[model samples]
Structures are given as C-alpha cells and as structure tokens.
Target: MTDDSSRAFVPGHVTGFFSVHEADDPEQAGSRGAGLTLSEGVTVEVEPAVETSMQLNDEPAAIEAVTRVLGDLGVEARVTATTDLPIGAGFGVSGAAALGTALAANRTFDCGRSENELVTIAHTAEVEAGTGLGDVVAQARGGVPIRLDPGAPEYGRMDGVPARSRVEYLTLGERSTEEVLAGNTDRLSEVGVDMLVRLVEKPTLPTLLASSRKFAREADLLTPGVEDVLEDVADEGGEAAMAMLGETIFALGNGLTRAGYDAEACEVHPTGATLEMD
Candidate 1:
C-alpha cells in the first residue's frame, strides 16, 4: 500500500462579498473587507485523524466535502480547527478550511490534484456550507480579488496587485456573517457591480480597489478605527480599505511596510496557506 499523507495550511481572508453575479446581472458585496493572517493556516494532514469533532454550524457540509475527497483518493483522515470568527464576519474561514482540507487530502493520499482543481473542490464545499459566495476564488487567488460576473466563476488574477498597496486587518471581536449581511443590503449597488465587471474584465484591480473601497464606506460596513487607520495609511502614500464585513481593514500603499502600521494592536497574517510534509 502507498503511504499517502500530507498536510496543508490554508490562510484566512477578510470580508467583503455582497453577491455573486447571476446569469442576467453582476453580483457584489460592498459592505465588507477582509484583512491580515493569524499565522495559522487551515492545517489539514493525512493519517486519518479519526472521528474528529467539528464545531462548525455546517458539520455535514464540511464532513461531506472532506469525505468525498477521501473517497475519490481512497484514503482516511481527520480534521479540526477553531471556530472563533463567526460566519459572515467577512473572514474567509470556511473557504480557507475547505482549501486546506483539499490540499491536505491530496497530500495525504497522493491524489495529484492541481491547485486549480483543489480550488474547484473548495468552491463546492463553500456552496454546500452556505457560508458565502466566491470564497473559493478568494482563498485560491487572493490579493484584492475582483470577480466581475457571477455564475461562470471566471476571475482575473491581477499582477502587481500589491505593487503600491498594503493591507492590514483589525479583529474587532466577532460578529455573525448572517447578521452583518442582514443589516447590509444597502451596500451592494448597481453601479458598483458594473464597475467591478469592468475592472475584472480588464483585469485592473488596483485602480478598481480605490472605487471599491469608496463603495464599502457608503454601505456602512467600515468598522470603528477603520477610517482613521485608512487615513494613516493614505498619509503614508497608499490606498486603504476595510475588508469583508468590517471584521478587518487593510491599508494598501507604495513603500508601506509593517512598521507603518500598529501590528501589535491587530492580528497579522500572510496571504496564502502552508504545506506540511511528513
């Protein structure tokens, strides 16, 4: 028998997803922003962690997603993680965990699925989990992601997205994704969706981010100290914005370093997941 077992750490993302564009129109979530990584990837390893207990609301969805991958690869495994950030906090925890599980399963079973393939699996898991939309794409291809249209799942990866940008996140306790969204129907606007469509189609994220940030403010999702922090980042010569659900805010700018912001006051995490090979 083959020794199939590996570990992968999927990073967490910020809030800011209104809706996925439907067949007839664009989708958007203007009242949110996601930021910072907590140095903890959604770690998934091989070796069948056995009868693990998951504390998430959608245990069935998460379990089913992992089980399907295991069945496809003919392997066994166990998984666990913290459920600190509630769903709809604008943090891409669900997507990150699903991505981590997929990668970990592949490594554990030697399934040989590509990055894109893993993204597809993660996306399916998100839909099943009912956490949010476009999470798979956000977790897989991060850094100011702009998905212009919906239904087709076509996204553009903008190079130099962080060329003149720096992102920071603040953990303002915890909030429910559903509650935030319930209170944030006004943030999603038609013009913003159209602009997102244009930006994604042309693949201009940095420029479009400026407008996106503005729309976020109009939607009343910006958290306390967010505008102040953004101003500080702007003073240092960069563009700043709040992320998914006001859970965190990121400041993007040219020559912006970690020193420019108060990292001690916030949770800082890199963009992306990690891999653990046994």
Candidate 2:
C-alpha cells in the first residue's frame, strides 16, 4: 500500500517586479513583485514509487522542478498535477504547480524538509526555467503579497495587503515569460520598483489596481486585446490591468463580464498552499 499526498495552491497575478540576479548566490536572485493570489489554482498529487514519473497538464517546464526536489530527497514518486487557470497568461500557474508539487511530494515521501526549503527549490526551478520570478514566494505566502526584497524565501522579504475582494480576469492569450525577460528590462524594472515603493507606502486594493495599470503602461506590456478589455472595463466604470508576463486582463470587479468578456471571478486567496493526505 502507498500513501498519497495532494497539495493545492492559488494562482497569483504579478503587478510588477524588479528582477535581480546574484550569480554567486542563487538564493539571493529573484524578483520583487506585488500581486494577489486568486482562488483558481493548481493541485498536485504524489505517491511513493520505485522511480520518479510526472504528469503536469502537459507543462514540460514544471518537470524539472518536481524532479529536482524528488531527486534531492532521493525519493522516487509518481506525480500528477492539474490546474484550472491558463498557463503563460501571467496567472502564475507554473509557480503554483511547482510549489504544490514540492509540498505534496515532501509529505508523500515523509521528507522532513522545512517549508522554506521546499519554497526555495520551487523558486529556483522557476527562475532557472524562466517560467516565473517571484510567483513561487508570493504563492507560498498568499494574499496580495509584496515581494519587498528579491530571491527565494530564505533570502527574500515579503509583505501583503490584508483586505480581500472579488477579482475578475479574462485570458487573452499566452506570452512567453522567457522571451520577455530576455529582452532589455531596464525601464520595466525601474517603473516596477517605483510602483512597488508607492504601493507599499499605501497598500490598498485601489492602489494595487492603479499601480498595476501604471506598471503596464510604463513597461509597455499592454497588448491590443488587453487594451480593449481595459477600455471596456473603464467604460463600465471599473478598473482593469494586465497580468504581468502574460496577455491576460485582470479586473477589480465584475465589470468585464458585464461588458461581454468571459471573466472568471474569484476571491483573493488569503493563505498559501496546503497539503492533505489520504
């Protein structure tokens, strides 16, 4: 008989971040971003096995993270993961999957790794794969998390907004985070840092939405589809902003749905990933 462990985590929408790298200290290299965790998320199931195998909703990039953690523990397992959100649309699906997998596999194999260690593994995998930057850490500590300092949990700092509200989003299409990050991000990082500072000084839902939109414009990340949704949201007297690293438009209210966009509505997830055994 084999015991299975399952873990689920909410997806986050990064408003902005300043990506930094410390080659000598991988743990100190990451982004400082602010975003909220949505109710939609990824779930991973793991059980002991003779050899490691993974099924990740056809997400190839996630395999490395799972395999790396399992290999480090010298624990073979069969891992399966699923998610409700679209990948590469800035919903942080990859980060959620990686974090959830780490948590589930750890418990499934009775590995005594601490939470911070698991988070570091997942964060490093995301960074190396270019799938995400600070999503893993933010997802580890849910709500409207502000990655005040860069890097994995062990070497990073985080804060968040306590007020929760309904969040609505529309998936426009996919954008490759790797491609975007590879480009010159001087202006983007500068604007992101400014926005982060402003938001931290006054952490509120309205401030987050406003700063997110400001970041999009300053970073030149808005696409035609995203612009259209934002316009529609505005006409309806609501605010909307593009999710970082993707083409999705996340609104603060249900205005997008009323404006004829198929917006998915969910509350802000107030906590991090969770694991259960059966």
Backbone collisions counted per model: 34, 0
lDDT (C-alpha) at residue 25 in model 2: 64
Give me candidate 2's TM-score against the actual structure.
Answer: 0.92
Per-residue lDDT over 92-201 for candidate 2, one digit per residue giving the tens place of the 0 to 100 score: 87777778878887777778899999899888877776677888898888888988898988678898987888888888788988898888888888888898888999
Task: Quote the lDDT for 132 in model 1.
Answer: 51
Instruction: Report the lDDT tens digits of candidate 1 across residue range 13-54.
Output: 653434433222212221122223443335554455555333
Worst 10 residues of 2 by lDDT: 13-22
Candidate 1, superposed: residue stretches over 4 Å from native: 1-4, 15-18, 22-41, 54-76, 80-89, 110-114, 142-144, 151-166, 181-191, 197-209, 231-238, 253-261, 264-276
lDDT of 2 at 135: 86
Residues forming the 10-long window of minimal summed lDDT in candidate 1:
23-32
Against the true structure, candidate 2 has what lDDT?
0.78
